[model samples]
Target chain A: MTINSVPSSKVRVRIGHLYGDLLNLYADRGNILVLTRRCEWRNIAVEVVSIGVGDRIGSGEFDILFMGGGQDGDQQFLEDDLFRVKADGLRGAVHDGVPVLAVCGSYQLLGHYYDPGTGPRLAGLGIFDMHTVHPGLSVRRCIGDVVVDWIGAPVGGPSSVVGFENHGGRTYIGSGARAFGRVVSGNGNNGEDGTEGVVQANAIGTYLHGSLLPKNPHLADHLIGMALARQTGSAKLEPLDDHLEWQAHQTILDRRASHVAPVGGRVKGSGGSAR
Target chain B: MRSRRLRTGFAVAMGQIAGWVSRAVGRGGGTALPGLVVDYLDPSALAHLARQLPGGVVMVTGTNGKTTTSHLIRAMLEAAGWAPIHNASGSNLSRGVLATLLRHASFTGALRVPENAIGVFETDEAAVPRVLRDTRARVLVVTNLFRDQLDRYGEVNAIAQQWRDAISALPGSHDLRLVLNADDPTVSALDGGSATTIRFGIGDPDVGRDAPDHASDANFCPVCGGRMRYIRVTYGHLGDFVCDNGHARPTPAIVATDIQADGWEGTAFTLKTPRGERRVSLPVPGLYNVYNALAGVASSEALGCDLEPIASAIGTFRGAFGRFERFTIDGRRLVMVLAKNPVGMNEALRTVVGRGGSGHHVLVALNDFDADGRDVSWIWDADFEILVGQVSCLTISGHRADDLAVRLKYAGVIGSIPSSGTVTVLGGLADALDGAVSGAPVGGTVVAMVTYTAMLELRSLLVRRGHARAYWDDAGVNSPEVTAR
Candidate 1:
């Protein structure tokens, strides 16, 4: 990969951060930082517009969409606004091939519904053919460093991505759906299957939330290229040195390979059982 | 009662034996082992031991500044001529409390202490309810609550609810006195019942930041789930706030005004209470320490101490171990500051950057050990960008040194290009310390910001090098020579 100093034309990219204030858990803003800085380094202008409750998403308003996880009750607080107000806009955007990246809780909300194994089932946007089920309060959360091989990627793109995962909902994709990757280590989506995330059109849904982008620059650029291809006329992106990023990514992979699972593993108990 | 005393005596003996064996084998400080053994032999050992104190227990709990605030309160109590038993080593679990009590107890399960002996303990956020149930502490001082160790303690709101339930469930005759931070909305609302609440806040508007911090864990109102409006924000969500649902900040009874924070020298502020006003000069840096000082004054006053001596004690207090400690190795000054979570790390960076001169040498060590939360994602949430133009040398260490280096790169402190000798990543703590200290001039200072376990390891390394004494052996603030920087 060569770093191009000059491009044929000036390109400006717009990003829509859904519920940026409410749904940002585990320092999810690092994804935004990675995307903006990578583009800036390539001399591409980027604008991030945070879309909160009762906010409207116009057509072609964004080239890429991102949503992150939140606290357990925070999802409940924003559920009505997400489903009633922004579901159709999100569905329309995904249909238009706008590259979307949704993390843990937001990924669960993008599915058909999330049954928390309690009183009510939270309705999702139905963007993907999947649904999540929390086994019960007795089951331990899938919290640990996760490594996944990027199975469905463009040729010569990122081979694998590494991040940290902390989620309780076990998401199962439908038979017709395709997976984003295969989990090489750590529990992903569920502990039973080797599947990690789901892929729908140009959208990606995963539970990896070490912000999921600073360490995996290749995956970030892959999303940027897709968004550029759909929104702009050209998809050409200049590559920069990712030495530190790759080192951070390989550090987790090396640690995972060298020892037993870092911290989180499958066990029984409630949320406060760590005490 | 006779049988119960005999059972307690047996548990105490067994716990002491275990602790002795643990120390003989060079395991740990044997902080939590004795408590675990006692809990197994006699489940109610904590309550039985805690009840023996003539002057009851005083607890300090919050997400941040628990250790420092408890240390300040203990100093204030000692200044008023009372010997207080404290968990000074910073082992703050329920078991750690039991261990402290066991260390103060006789082999026959009897507490041996001075006639004016009291108890002061800093407890973990999740273990508050358990500690309360055991000690029945008469005075509880809450500094502030921030989102910390989500992997271990779950969520901030869940912990708040647990604290409220615990407070409300106390016996009617317990007469609990609640000392809270009025600037923190979540902590201010913890006093819902009939307990006498002494609220403390920063009244100086000059210290407020122009823009809110990145970590706003308490932006939502604690009373109702509505978005809160901050009239003034001191730091990270600590400010005067109001919700549209009629919930507003209470008028703090104890307030700090006319603040002046000198980077490492210390922070001075006017401590105002109903009794009178006194100017307190704290030997600690940052606005968060101002809050810690006010909490110490409010808590000790609740324990029947005069405001004059309390202010003097806070004025001369050095600091808790690893919160901010100084050492001299070959004439190079090493300042160790503990940065556990995002908010704390932000304040630590702000203090370092606010120091007078440029070319600041900083060694940041981040670990993912059990003590330091396994998920190191919170580093991204901290504002290391403040070091962009200030840091002349940056060294990253600990188990997650690569992650910290990457974070500093994205924060613009480290360039995107290859190594330029400005940023170095060394995984070994001792090597990183040596590199950072030697990279600076002999007369210059090197600031070391580290996580919980990393600070412990670094302090141990310093002790081994004969730079400082062991933390558990540290005498109180009465001896000015020990803490003289």
Candidate 2:
């Protein structure tokens, strides 16, 4: 089948990194870097504008909106900014079918609310139909290397994406939302559900942040292609050699598999357990 | 007390046997294993062993520089004619301290050293409370606190709370002296109500940066919720900072002034303490080491050591192993630097790129083991972008080579490499080391920036290759052939 193509016209893909400085707890800026480099490699023009607290973005300013995780203290400070300054702009961007990737803390903030178990419930942007809550007093954070089978992409995405997830909030997808993937290993969203992340409209929210992109080139390319398609009406991105990227992704998968306990075997205890 | 001493003696004997058996079986140093066995046999082994030191115990705990600072203090004390026992194996855990103490103890559970022999220990940040609960420490030297190992220790504030609780619970008669980093707001705020606190910092404004880096932590004032305005940010959130509410960095009792950081050659500075001013030419690179040296000076002075010998000892002190140790192999130079966090990694990268010569090679090894903090995402926070167009070649290695390779690629380092082969990713450390060494031009240096466990692994590989001595076998600071540059 001949793939539909459009003439390359130096398409400018703008990305607005919300809370680029404050909410970068897990190197989430790497995701923005990955997006920018992947586009530059294809001769596509890319621009990234950092939108921190009190910073505003125009409705049509960016093709992709990226948000990363931050410390609990930072999240508490950013909650007011997200609602006051960025909620409308980001909501319009998502409504325009612009691709959004929010990880960890920002992922929780994209939902309706985030209840951190002890403090006042934080208001979210209500972009994705979901809510996150702390796993209560007795439960620890759901953290480790995670592997998931991709389920939200239309076509040509990878069968699986591997990354690391470290978060205390367990998100539950609401009735209007859909899960981005099926959890293959490690806790996702919550340990109870075999689901990881939320996919609503063109926005995706996840806890996976081994930077979330460099290892999963397909997902990175998918978001890039979606951004380009939105810009140029229709486009097919030329693929770069991802041999090393696949190697890295497969390595994480293998590591996760090895770390997972065998069926009915002894559970691996948390770190700091004396031998 | 007699029965308890007898039990401790029996435990020490068993621990020694265990250490011998483990070493004979080629299972590495087995330092912590002996302590574990001892603790299992006698729960009071650490307390009993710690009580034998006539000079009392000194505890050093912080997020970074704990090992190096404790080592420097130990060296200063030794130079002053005091035999100091320390956990020199880079093992700062409770069991590691117990094992070191047991090694110095006689078979009768009595310290075998001289009467004035002291005990200096580097305790893990999270393990400080537990260590203080057992031993009667006379001095507690907290270097600084940053957000590290979030998966292991919840958050910076949580760890600070733990430390506060630990300090509050100290006995009324303990008379503890606290040596803290005045620049680090989180660490400086950890002053216990009754303890005598001595603050140390860098007073040289010339060495400070114009602004804080992206990964700088504790940017807000601890006293007020106002944003902190830094007058001079040496590195990260360290240096002189003030808040709108009039809260400012504490006046450090011991400060390094007139700083001259000569890159890899060494840093020469004049230390101004309450006692007097002494010029200290520390044979180490990076401002972090300067801070570590200042911490050592303040800590030693707090313990009543003379200023001249302490400054002289710090001047000659080479850094702790893997902190930044230089070695020459096959006409190529290897500088091993430990980069466990973003702040540390950025400093290492700055030191490397600041070398200013071409044909420089960097091999970054990352591991997600418990020791190295299972989350490897902090690599993104490190400013590897500085090396994008700078280095001639780059190699990514270790268990998480791909993750690092991806980070480097996104940082624009890989794309800037003139050739594809220059940005190679080798999974095995042995192969990566061999490739990096051979790949380097003759006389060119290969900076091996590695994490904690990876540093250990790389050092072992070097030891096997006859490149360096085993850390356990190396003598103290005055060991011959151990030079500054």
Candidate 3:
């Protein structure tokens, strides 16, 4: 599916947001805003279409795809629709190299299955060669500010991205999948392997979602470049002034570096300094 | 048993000493540390002291509006001539409740409040079960539950289950009165408990949004696990909904209707109750405050207070500390609203826009402090786009100043330099406050929307400038003499 390049004109791009209603728990819509705004700032016309349950995904209809995390109950309710209706289409798009970004719950759902320790095993779309386990109710969730040195860094692009991670499930990636990045701080993936997410082809899955993209413009641009490549056959993107974005990203990293250790734990209401 | 009493006495004495030292050292105002000390020494100290209150205890818990609603309830109780001990500093955990009790307790670990004294405490959402276990509150007001601090409280569903379990586990003899929000499906479903449940909701369908907010969490029915559809949505997930499994919104015993909002001046509504209808006006702005007032009225009535007195007391109640708190400096007005989560921030922006008309000067201070829920991503989920065409000057500050800048920029609030007026990004709270206030024209209003800790910092700055009083010294919610300023 090739798109003809029109020189010196606005190139309209369509972004497909899967389950925009149900699967947006952790401010995940910000990632979509980042993509659209970056495209708009560069004069690349953008339109976002929300494809919810009982909807069909036509081939080559989207330049990029996004799915976000959701509460467990909401995720459970949508599993049937996700697998029965959209699984084959989603797999087809990934096979076709349509760039996709899945964060947190959606990342877990891209794997083989998720065993929540108590409920019945939930099947995933098996797009990524990994599986997640909740361990149990007694185990603490991996939550705190997280930093990752992205393994698939583009030339002259940001190599490190910072975001927040909050999840109970421990994900283990198999040989079929490549580690998305090396965890520089806080708990990542299983909190034991020092791995953060999984990367397979043009698709990426991660738990780092302080919306994960606005502050990390490099990752946003990388995904945007890949998405645009499907149409223009060129991954070159003109840079915008990212002064505020980089400052925000660096602030989290600087805070982590200054602290003796990462600020974590169930900080009681009355205790703990605000900063 | 005698040794246990002696241990409690020793704990009280030591805890008081610790509190004195904490206050003397310029720490907190001895709000929660003493309770922590008492809890460490004797776990049963809270239960023992709570039982001594002749008027029993009332606990209010929710994701948002806990402090404001709790304050309103405390003021209503005070107006009813009951000496109420409340956690006025907004320290809402079990320790904070224990500290409030400890303040009115004797050195021998006995309550020293008057014979008509009552306990009115706000509790953190996750700490509800533990707080319920200790206090066995005669009345538990469950305000609307929204997703708050996922890093701390986990998921909303998990917290809802925890609350259901806690309420169901209450013994039949305690006779706990459950004040549930009928518009909130998650809260309305919390009626499985044996407590006498009184539900309150908004009845004006005109106020509901045509579409559900992106921050809504209760899409699935809390009862039969079926998908739910909303007929009307006020804000966020609070609305009239029915599930595929026939579960529907409960008929509220108390409902608000014919709402009239006068910008920041406040909202006046007709409150409908079984006893009779009363016209109530709240100094706090927004529909969220209406929900808060409904909760306060329901809880007060459950405690045997009459509707007329409750309505009147609510009208006389001033805003909570840093919640719609107004201050006059130079020649401009600075109204502060605390917005720590998406739903709360959405309401805050709505109130600010509603009050200041079209060309409003707004300041948003965001902090990733532990108390402020370290993740700042929720700002994107909030509907700051409402201020897109309504704002003339926008100022952002605090720990995540640039983060908020990015969010507002995307929301189109920080538009092209010439069209949207001006945008200021500062790292310091005081500088941002000055920038926002000065940016407004003379006689114009500047609304400050801040997080928990940032609000604290801003309030302290105001105090230093002799514009406001320290929260601890201000008799805001407790003193009947203090009316809406």
Candidate 4:
């Protein structure tokens, strides 16, 4: 239940994509837009921004942070910039409960270090107790439904079959760290079964893409509600209508419906993300 | 004698059964079984089933021109009166091809394969050595190489080198026949003295593509690692070429001559070879297609198919599935062109844009995937500079609409970028097509240059809408030869 405070305002979220750096996952931006749009419907002014290198990042200045996937070269080029900008204070801000949604490369960056090294070994800001290692290019393509057991606040519960995943980074949790969620059919965390994603405090990261928000807006609403809750110290959010998002979700259902199976009535292994 | 790959009444019979099953059990995936069947079947059992015929195997490969060129060669073989077992469905992978072979093997395991039928396969560029080692194809058609699938295949140069090493490493005992595209310096290197090689290309400088179409992948010599020199570039990086080093140079065993490309009217070229020059006019409308047809004819001849019928058949041949498939959408005659890579897209765009069809509507579907190559930076290289306000209406769709729109905006193209610039980054396939078609005035032609997966989606959508027919049903058993106009 989203508990809204009396003095609630529209929260805007911006995805600072260096345009073509990461954000390769089609589902990544959808997550952000869906998040903002859902918040707007909730009578909250959620302004999502496309921040870049020079953008400002101060504590208590924003509600949520998002970064998406990219190729190895993209990750390499942004290494120095991300290392300098997204470190320490910002990591701490995110750690102290500024809801951040990291997907793929960005998810790797949130870890202690990204190993098997894409180019140079990428060291994270130690925001999350995880180290992502490249398993030398295995086709870790995940299609069909992605179910996430939400570990964060507001939506602190189990959610099943969200979307798809295609990544090479084997996110192995460190000694003390725990998994974000379960993956029904993907190597979400170190090739474990039911690998959905991970959540530490207010931060949630996963490989599910295409702005996973619009198709699976429940997750988006959950994330936004959480972010707004963090910003206002209130878990309550006003109601909103989402026919367009429902239509988008219906599109996925229609596509899967065309390729339904006999045993489970599911369409498995059919997605366009070939990373 | 070769044995039949598809048993009699297998496809037709199985088609009914599958249809019934789909109706009964709802529906199922079209491509999932290829990999599943291959993974489940024993390798020896599969290999044994593959060789149940005397025709053996012949594989064709390259980055671009593989589909059109191989299809041409297959038709020519059949026209020259040869039974050829092929994966004409254009599923060019081990699993896909394996499933194709499964349809033909016999119940007794004694393959009733086509006696005169020769197994003509278009293998994936990276998967060639594996397919070759397995089938030991007697003849291999090596088309040009280019930069593609950077996320998976890596650099173009790396793939070319891998191709050379793979071909060269093959056992000398096998009569490894090779058909090389001399215009492409990277592929011509496969003609190393060890293998029996036959080079095919074009010589008509007048009708050749004015310059690089921007998406040319292979722009260097693979042998000496030196910059390659080009006498003429037909499209992208493909053209008549020679390396500064003596190691790689164009051979004149086969050449496309007397070329004539009438914008959208059609393209026709003469295949000039050691035997003689025979002009064939193809319905395909681009000089790039002339090279494809010539390569197909040349490859067919290398496999002992007569050049006369092959040439004649190509002259009358219609368009491939989507290279130039035409149909009526919203009462307008629209021509569809499949454009996956930058080179392919540029050539298709040039064909239409040159015809002053900018006044006409154009729809583009760009998908950046492992299938379409993750590194879509190549869009910067595509000659979309030609697309402009002259185009009355333009619609762009696919996975990365914003990315593609950004590329177009950067190109200063005055047409729709599918984002903000007079474009609609449609959320659905049907909506995109409807948006594109609806924007064009009645009777206005809509030309769509779509990527591979997009092509399939668009085709399926169009077919479902009753606006188009399955391509195989249109082309018939053997599409006519495209003769030089």
Best by lDDT: 3
Q: Which lDDT values do the candidates have, in the order given?
A: 0.84, 0.80, 0.85, 0.61
Where model 1 places Cα greater than 4 Å from the true spot, the runs are A1-9, A232-234, A263-275, B193-195, B416-421, B475-485
Candidate 4 local lDDT, B1-485, one digit each (tens): 12322332233234333333433552322222433343343444345555654667778888777777777876777787676666665667765456455445444444555467677777787778667776778888877776554445544555665666777787877677888887776677676654358887777777555455434444445665444566677766677666667554556588877777776668777777766777777887876777777777767767776668877888777656777888887687778888776667777877887786346577777775457764444555566767865565667678655445544543446333334335556645678888888787788788888888788778878877898765434433122222212
Q: Per-residue lDDT of B25-126 in model 1, one digit per residue for the tens?
A: 655666778889998999888999998987899999998899999999888988887778888777788888888788777888998877788889899887
| Pairwise DockQ winner, candidates 1 and 3 | 1
**TM-score pick, better of 1 and 3:** 1
Give the winner by DockQ. Answer: 1
Chain A TM-scores, all candidates?
A: 0.92, 0.89, 0.92, 0.75
Least lDDT summed over 10 consecutive residues: which range in candidate 2 chain B? Answer: B476-485
lDDT of 3 at B225: 86
B384-428: candidate 2 lDDT, tens digit per residue:
888977877788899888888877877778878776348778879
Per-residue alpha-carbon lDDT of candidate 1 for residues A1-275, written as tens digits (9 for 90 to 100): 01123443456678889988667678988998888888878777777788988997888888889998877667677888987889889998989889999998889889998887875887788899999998876777888888998887668776788998887789999986788889888888887788999999889999998879999988899888987887566677887998889999989889887977674743311333111
Ranking by lDDT: 3, 1, 2, 4
lDDT of 2 by residue, A1-275 (tens): 01122324567888888877666677776788788778777877777878866878787788888988776665666777788888888888888889999988788888998787777887778889999888564566676778899896557556798777767678999999999899988888887889999998888999898778878888998888889888787758897988878988988777765765411111122221110
Best-to-worst order by DockQ is 1, 3, 2, 4
Tell me the spans in candidate 4 whose CA falls farther than 4 Å from its real position: A1-275, B1-39, B207-216, B244-248, B368-370, B373-375, B415-422, B471-485
Best by TM-score: 1
Chain A, candidate 4, TM-score of 0.75
TM-score of 3: 0.95
